[model samples]
Target: MCDILVPLTANAQRIGTEEERKLLDQSIQLCQRLLIEVTLSEATKLVGRAEYEDALPGSIQALRFSLEIYGSGRSELIPCYILLAEANLGLSRFKQAEECLCNANWILIKTRDNDKKVKSILYRGFGRLYAAQGKREEALRQLANDVSPNAALTDTVC
Candidate 1:
């Protein structure tokens, strides 16, 4: 319901990509629960596509913007963080990815929302993060927390 405008002077580019812009438009257009759900769904699907170099950034931006508006209490926040961690994992930005996952974990526990599913995803992100750091032992430990049990998988998260 509020218009957000930023000054664009001196070769300023959009903070996020076109796909992110569209998702934000869709979320804002309706300003209803269902529309937000749709936006979250679309963003998750985009993250699941795993084309990291392209789509993930936009999805990440869209999710972050959505969270900024919706607040961290929403269930969708966990997925957004997971998607962000995955994107960072793909790009080998281990520290940022770890921070994202840690935030998700903190929210989940703080809210007392016993959603094991989201926790599993968080563990997967941790697994990937550790793997990216070449810490196989830690990676395996976290990866074991995921839904699908695997000890021999070469790259559980990465």
Candidate 2:
């Protein structure tokens, strides 16, 4: 959604669940045309709307498309894995989130691209996950590892 279309989500969501579902279904279908870029863009917009559960289907689709376009071992898959992890976290699916994060970690290790931004995101996500699970101390530890410059509010895992 563009800046001009930002109000569309908020306005339509107030109509009704069935109506929202119908519109979202159509949007998801449209996202399948280009597969990767458009789909991921929509998935990100869904996340921005705090529609994590709604984002999951598109996020999963984006992941498959990313793997198809960039292969499993490429750094490009990191964003897809992290996006799924974020959605899983939003849905309170801790195990699935952790699995997705672990896959991302494996990609980083395999590629030896343990880049700072990636580490920050991984740890930040770990922090969120641990907090969700009622492990404040562990969450703090994970957060401590998330010490990257301008990482706190500047960007996201995806």
Candidate RMSDs in order = 9.7, 12.1
Backbone clashes, candidate 1: 0
State the lDDT of candidate 1 residue by residue for 1-158, as single tens digits: 11222221123444588998777656543454443455456656655776565645545555655565677766657777776777777778788788778877777767877666676777777877888899999888888867554422322232
Candidate 1 lDDT trough over 10 residues, lowest sum: 1-10
Q: How many backbone clashes does candidate 2 have?
A: 0
Best by lDDT: 2
TM-score for each model: 0.63, 0.69
Please report the TM-score between candidate 2 and the true structure.
Answer: 0.69
Off by over 4 Å in 2: 1-34, 148-158
* lDDT, candidate 1, at 11: 34
Predicted candidate 2 versus true structure: per-residue lDDT over 83-144, tens digit per residue = 88998998899999989988897787789784887878898888899999998997887787
